[model samples]
Target: MLSLFLFQISLNRMIKTLSATNYSIEIGPLTESSFQDLLTNKYAHSRKVIMVDENTHDNCLEFLLTAFDDLTDAEVILLPAGEENKVMEVCFQVWNALSDYGIGRNDLVINLGGGVVTDMGGFIAAVFKRGVDFVNIPTSLLGMVDASIGGKTGIDLGAFKNQLGVFKDPVAIFIDPSFLHSLPENEVWNGFAEILKHSLIADSSLWAKIKNYRNIDDLYTADLIEAGISIKLKTLLNDPFEKGERKLLNFGHTIGHAIEGCMLETDSPVSHGHAVAIGLLLESQLSNNRGILSNEEFKEIEETIKALYSPIELDEEQIAIVLELMKNDKKNSEGKIKGILIHSIGHCTFDEVFEEEEIRKIL
Candidate 1:
């Protein structure tokens, strides 16, 4: 009887492992068998290429290889890790790698790292042969919830972040939360920033859940990925092409992207989430100033973000540069600056453009 009980427990563990591969986020939980299923069923006969960075290669290459075991032939591409590395130069590197791999239109590429890997790889796949299918196997929290789920793929152009990219959804995305255990503390914090943003935009319940997240360990659990992905998917399903109300996803991204550009101009670039953390606070203040967001709600946002990240002071000069970046933001229409602002939890709207002078004072 005891032997039978042990066998049942082992079978259940295997079943749990198999169940993780169907996730939409990047770093949820994936197993070797699930990957095989994707390759054999959904993407059979599709040439495969996996893109990664140095750190991700060191950390996850072995597991990735096991996932691709059935593939007799595959290609691997590597890039430098960090926000600074997500650029045209790296894009060119991927282009070259794809060329060498002979990746064709029918082929599929797998991005196997954090946001940088997935974002750049997805962009290459989108443009390669005028577009091909791609998949995401994100290894970081930020990549899982934000970058991997949305069809928003691109590389940073010059000092501008995400200035060059496209919105091409992948054939499939698999998240394995096991990867989060390997992430650095700061990287984990970076991902939490996006999770918090999701909650603020459309799911007050999720915001409340994240508010109580005590540390990195809390985010690695399956519950965080499940809740975060559900919120993001709901938003994208409503705005797949980002043509309308979906702009709510930019809650903190408006100023965050600009701040990212500012830091990129300097030698040190901020993580996407770190920059967005500052953006969230500043934008919350903007919402309050506009009288849409209540001061108390703004205070809640400020306290929540500050609980996890330290404030980065931006001087007048820095603010000027960020404004320039915002002027070129993709959401801007024919040179008019537009922003997505929040009025309350689960409430957001776009089409309000902030004046350069006005933003300067806010800075």
Candidate 2:
């Protein structure tokens, strides 16, 4: 059904289930029975709705339909693809569709696409009629490792990333790595950016191993996927919400989101992963200048990231725009711009207010 096997590890060897406070994530080597049986048993009586974007509609929706007959009657909602589509207008339209379908709180929504689908669909289910149970069937590498795993569901407000949203977990998340084949190379790198961030913030050994890879191919193994998932899970254990330790996950995201907004204004828009890759390097440098990260470590971080990703060249105007947006980032308090920084690889510090001048020094 899905090439049977996509990686070196066989079905059984790859790690299986992981749980957070209320939900569980079922990683690769999934079977029709593993997915279908649960749906038939648990959701037989619930109205089914499967939401996806244009790409997932063409690439992934059929695979899911063929695998699970339980979804035969599921209402399919197809959203327009791309970051720009992740807006309140789209959400409002989806809401109207839900109303048209007669969907209610007792129903179930299967978010069957990449990050955008899971993020926006979860938001739709959460706020619709006070809340509807939803599940994530992440079909992108980024979706599998980061977006779908966390309870953060949101849409962009203009160009700002995740500007409007909620922190509501899906009932379950089904991550089948077979879907990796459906992605273009750029899409794969987008997810790798988040996974790379994970290694830096909490897993030094993982980051060390990651740097040794000469080809991006080496990064796409089930072993690494499971390991990355575990690192993100570790944070959820102590801080399910972004109340404390979970903020570490937002390290590269602050500047990354701002960079993302800047590119959307240009001719060639940047993908989330591309923007985050750039943000990681800049923030790592910011950490160094702020005296939190060591000089040698910053060089290593810069070298490793630059080798894999082309650095973004922001013009003077764009730099000012990015700095202004950083001041208004969600992580900031009152008026100070704050973000996570690694004092050492695999370790980080937060609640550090970065002065505008300090940020300008790095930019």
Poorly placed runs, candidate 1 (over 4 Å): 1-28, 41-44
Residue-wise lDDT of candidate 1 within 207-264, one digit each (tens)?
8767867666687876677667667666765567788877888888888899888887
- Candidate 2 lDDT tens digits, 165-265: 88888888888888888788778877888888999999899888886565657656767778888888877666776878888998888889898987886
TM-score of each: 0.89, 0.93
RMSD of each: 6.5, 4.7
* lDDT values for all models: 0.77, 0.83
The positional error of residue 242 in candidate 1, measured at the CA in angstroms, is 1.2
Q: Which sections of candidate 2 miss by over 4 Å?
A: 1-15
Q: After superposition, how far is residue 147 of candidate 1 from its true place, in Å?
A: 0.4
Q: Which candidate is the best by lDDT?
A: 2
